[model samples]
Target chain A: MAEAREPAIRTRGLNLWYGDFQALFDVDLDIARGRVTSLIGPSGCGKSTFLRSVNRIIERLDYVRTSGSIEVMGQDVLASDVALTQLRREVGMVFQRPNPLPISVRRNVLFAHRLHNPHGQSRAEEDELVERVLREVLLWDQVKDRLDSLATGLSLEEQQKLCIARLLPVKPSVLLMDEPCSALDPEATSAVEELIWELRGDYSILIVTHNMAQARRASDECIFMLLGKVVEHAPTGDMFVTPTHSETADYIEGRYG
Target chain B: MASPGGDRSGPDHLGREWWWDKIAQVLLFGGGISAIVFIIAIFVFIAQQGLGYALVDLDLATYFTSPEWRPTSEPEPVFGALALIVGTASVTGLAMLVSVPFSIGAAIFIGEFATGRTREILKVLVELLAAIPSVVWGFIGLMVMSPLLMDVFDVSVGVSVLNAGLILGLMAAPIMTTIAEDALKAVPDGFREAAEAMGATRWQVIRQVVLPSAKNGLVAAVLLGVGRGFGETMAVLMASGHSINMPTSPLDQVRALTATIAAELGETARGSDHYRVLFSIGILLFLVTFIINLLADMFVRGKKTAR
Candidate 1:
């Protein structure tokens, strides 16, 4: 039924194992397009694993084994014929910690763009691209004069914004963020949350967060997961007011993690 | 309790502790300072002994510019080191050319691609290569490599610059591979994951992300390898034939600075001009290695500051 509605990302029978220990158990999810879907769960509840699985980054670990299907825009991303590079280009990721390359801020923004589009861009085009993305992330004016400076010199908040900006050049359909603002202070968190709110309607955003308030404040829809299974997925307001499952209610009320 | 100083008070306890502390401090300081003192003493001694002959007695211009290196001749003994310098440069250059690609490739393979049992085995093998003594490597070059080169190139003499370079490359590869692999391994997993998330291929991630992050370390590795190649003696002494001529081709028989010193140091009498000239060559080798290490240190410091 969710698939019929043309969701941005749809997963079916998604199972994952780390060596002998299974982390996910037949997880089926349908994340809608042009909406912010927040995945909230306790630690080690497979939230980050699920996000990494969507982009096939989980495969980087030699011990990780994943099963079942993940589809992005009607294409089966888990299919053997699907090129990993192609899947990744369409589905961008923001990690728990902002990992900007040690290169200059401008080069960090252009890295993925250059890799995906090897045909090359002119210097003026690169400048425009940098400006547009940095502006979109609300970081252009602060970082404009220091575009040539090393990205590692930026503040945690600016670095996280830069990380998000770097993903925009490839024009990914779905953005998977795994605790993107977990490292920031309260002020920086709100700023990043505002940026995420601004980014809605243009890209389908799936964020995993431990902060219950963040999930409620930032997301249009909230997905509550527990013990590697989805407990509830509902509108943000409805989920907070009246959770269908007791586990979701317990988690939201901070009764028990 | 009564103390030997006859103070028998709390202040006496403090005084006793301070006395022991001073002794310990002096001992530790001496231990630390001795290393620097020894290095400075060696440098001063070498300069005093060698500079008298190299700079004061002999023409400094001829020592650097003239190719003729005859130390024993009628009326005039030429101490020019131009040929030996060229020999050292060419042999080291060739060794680098042969070893750099292989070492870096092996390092990348071991550090990035290899996993599980294969990585362990390759690492052990590299360690074994490094453990092999310099003399053994020289023997291998003299017995095995020289003949192979002679047959392959159809040259009259098997021991040539090419042979020395090849053998020196083998001698240097383990050091290069081990250090370069460590450099590659030091690249954080986050960079790799970030690049992978961007849909970059494994090779692309290595080239665009990993290598750039590890650039300073890699440069340091190469500089260390160059220093190792430059200072290596036994392998070059055995395989290079020690023909004191400026090498025109890799196949030409040549003499390196290390090989020159090793071959002539024993034959020259103590405190003779020839002996002091050998000391001068040692000074040159010292300066070269020191500069390379200094450059490597700068790169390492730069990497630290950037991070």
Candidate 2:
């Protein structure tokens, strides 16, 4: 059993609201550490909201309200004195769209590291870090010669890779990807899926995706959410073959989204 | 017309939308080209009015170097413009110093910090500030700002370089803030979200990502403000004291080129050297504003292609 190991993220009785509208119900989940777990559901099912709740990025909206607890790497992030920057450093995120800074590729990779280490590392150390992270994202060979060029100039796939690369320098314990490849083409999607797979075991990744096939192929564990509640959490093969709930089965069979 | 099963004999249409569309196209084209036509017409008119004096008998040496501008003396009327040029430059330079910080700060607050009713209210107030007439601003400079400056700096005269600069700076700030806010708004919110997600503090995100991302547009905003300050006449005329002195300090009184033409053009007889020289000043003002505007436009376009 994996009982001896601590979970990467633990949510207990978590509820969320946006002004008058409640978006998430009292949901509880324990995402196993260092695994690729995909949250799959229909539109407005709150899968992405649940993912955002863990890192508390949605708090940027003034009207958003949350209760209960979300602990990232065993720290209760919802506590007032908890420094968000520190939490964000531990739990990095990639958005639905590849949102790389309008800066050089080399700087993009080093953005988070610079945030954490204000005094900064020397040029050789930074160069090594950039190379190491870019290589980890499988993007170094293509962008090696153009490190100083704008990251925005890269293709969507490369941009997405760069976005992921930018997060790695901070050595985040968890990476939450909200449909990271939805904007990418099929070829790019598979390429990014492979890259995501390559990143597994090194970092705990909770990915929210709409594609059933991608969920089946890419993730080790799968969770099905409906109406802001977790419907099922099982191994990817078992869930696809024999879903625990009819909603999960219907969702997988394309009966209705 | 042809039957469904039969071959067509000639090209034909059932709809009557063709002629209306043609008329609309002609009308829209005329509307689109009116700006270019008007600009060219104005330039030609200014050139025609000033060409005789500027080309034939302008005393190029005295016109540029000498500060004496006695255009109504009995024996000999000097036509030097060095003082007027410096006056305009100094007023506008001081104005930029006062306006840039206020404009950028207000823009950042409106675009990045303020929300809900506060944002809407601030935006409306800024726009109202811009809509206030230039003459009214001149009145404020003459009646209020000048006296205030005199009290603050312990100067004998109320209207000086400082007074005009303060008034013009306030006058120019609304437009500058509006444009700078637009520039900041143009930077996609995604960049802010991306930076914030990277453990960057709010200030860090703005300083490192948002400002740099919107740098071109912000520069364009400042340049446009400079253009606004350059062509402004009424406010500069009222606040700049209309003195012909070459200023060595902020307290010294000076006169702007725009003020000179606005003030002396009516008094001078038609076709006189003074009249033609006023038109020459108009030509210079036109050229300076045109170049500043062109540069601003290019910077705005740079932001577009960067994405």
Candidate 3:
């Protein structure tokens, strides 16, 4: 399986602290290429922290410190020499809520593209790019008639989809989603889950979720975490059916979070 | 159905409490309503006195068109307001030109870039600037800025439209900065995060996301600044040389509407045409500031609803 291939993201001895409070232990992980890897745990288990660390977004907070090496596409992202903008261009991230710029839908989709490609694009090229990305995220048919409308005016589901669509134009290799569907209803969650599933084979995705059923249903590989430590990382079916550790077993069986 | 303790109090107690509540409500409402009433009364009084002269005693065409503004001449007192209008416009326009960019930049720096102790210090300094009185600003203009202008521009008299504009701009900047900073702070952090995650630099995020989100508030800030510059009297009167002529250039001496009214209102005879003309200038000034403030309110409201 392609899941057995080289890792898209590899981290070693990833320890992180916020101020004096350590949030991540000596963690090690190898998320496979072209696979949807779900990081699931109870609240405050540092699942989101782990996901954010992959893209180095946690460092945005002044007090955050990490002693780790995170390699994306075989390049060390933790190195001081690496340009942040360049690293981020190769790795896109979506937040807990859908946050498209308060601009028109078309501009929200084209913002990152224009930023990365400052030489500029022709009108036809921009139109095609917008449509292509929107269609990939299953939003083109719904919002095609009102591309100039403000993105914030859309329903929550469409806004989430648009947020995802905006990332595609940058052509990042890996997409990190931090509870991307947390703000949506159940039906909208499933819709976004399907979109994420569809995107799996083309892009390596790391999704953090507290929903066990969502992790089981949507991911190819699942990593269980507890107290900033990884308990088990296995194929989704195997992890659910026959967990190696008692913690994982208890968690899946709904014995305890 | 007797209560544990309330049975001891009769309906009269409830009635007394309700009566006191009504009195409190009336007092609060009256205080709020009186402000509006006073505003309307002032407008009515100014309009009645001013319109009587403008419509009856004055030649409307010469009042509006002629640059000559000699009101105390022997046979026929001329009350041309064209020069005063130009003076007000020039001074306010120059003030906006000087203040807008600096205020916006300062606001962006304070709101978006600075952090921790630096942010706190800058904020306190800005508030201190706002607390300084207009009369003190006028004093500063008279003593410090006027001499600087005289030395730098080599003008005969230091006080000119440019000098007044520079002083008024300084006076208006604190308000502009404070409001603009609030608007910038109001932009969601999620926008910055999203832009950054999409490989945008800090500058790119600010320009494309933060600024566009805060556009309405920024425009409102500029409008408020313009209102401040328009209505300011003492500083302009003290620093503008109070010349009653068309301001040919920024360096030329000028007299604004506010300055004219302040300088002449106390000296004019109570029932004379000159007194009514001063009131007419007051009406014009009031209307200009009123329109600017109205526009600012609309933009501020637009920002709120857009969110």
Find the candidate with the highest DockQ and give its number: 2
Local lDDT at B262 for model 2:
93
After superposing candidate 1 on the true structure, give the runs of residues whose Cα lies further than 4 Å from its correct spot.
A1-4, B1-34
- lDDT score, residue A133, model 1? 97
2 versus 3: better TM-score goes to? 2
What lDDT does the true structure give each of the candidates? 0.91, 0.93, 0.91
Weakest ten-residue segment in model 1 chain A by summed lDDT: A1-10
lDDT of 1 by residue, B1-307 (tens): 6758756665446676688999999999999999999989999998887877776777779889988988766578788899999988888888999899989999999999999999999999999999898888889888999889889999889888888888889889999999999889989999998888898888998998889888898899899989999999988888888888978788888888898898888898899888998899989998999899999989888888878
CAPRI-wise, candidate 3 is high
Query: Taking the tens digit of each residue's C-alpha lDDT, what string does model 2 give over A1-257?
Result: 26678889988999999898888898888888989999999999999999887778898999999998988888999999999999999999999999999999999999999999999889999999999999999999999999999999999999999999999999999999999999999999999999999999999999999999999999989999998889999989999999989999999999999
Question: What are the iRMS values of all candidates?
Answer: 0.7, 0.6, 0.9
Q: Residue A254 error for model 1, in Å?
A: 2.1
Worst 10 contiguous positions by lDDT, candidate 3 chain A: A1-10
Tell the DockQ for candidate 2.
0.87
Error of 2 at B107 (Å): 0.5
Quote the true-contact fraction of every model.
0.85, 0.88, 0.78
Model 3 over residues A131-244: C-alpha lDDT tens digits? 999999999999999899999999999999998899899898999999988999999999999999999988999999878899999999999999999999999999999999
Q: Is the docking of candidate 1 incorrect, acceptable, medium or high quality?
A: high
Give a tens-digit lDDT track for model 2, residues B204-249. 9999998998999999999999999989999999999989989999
Clashing pairs in 3: none
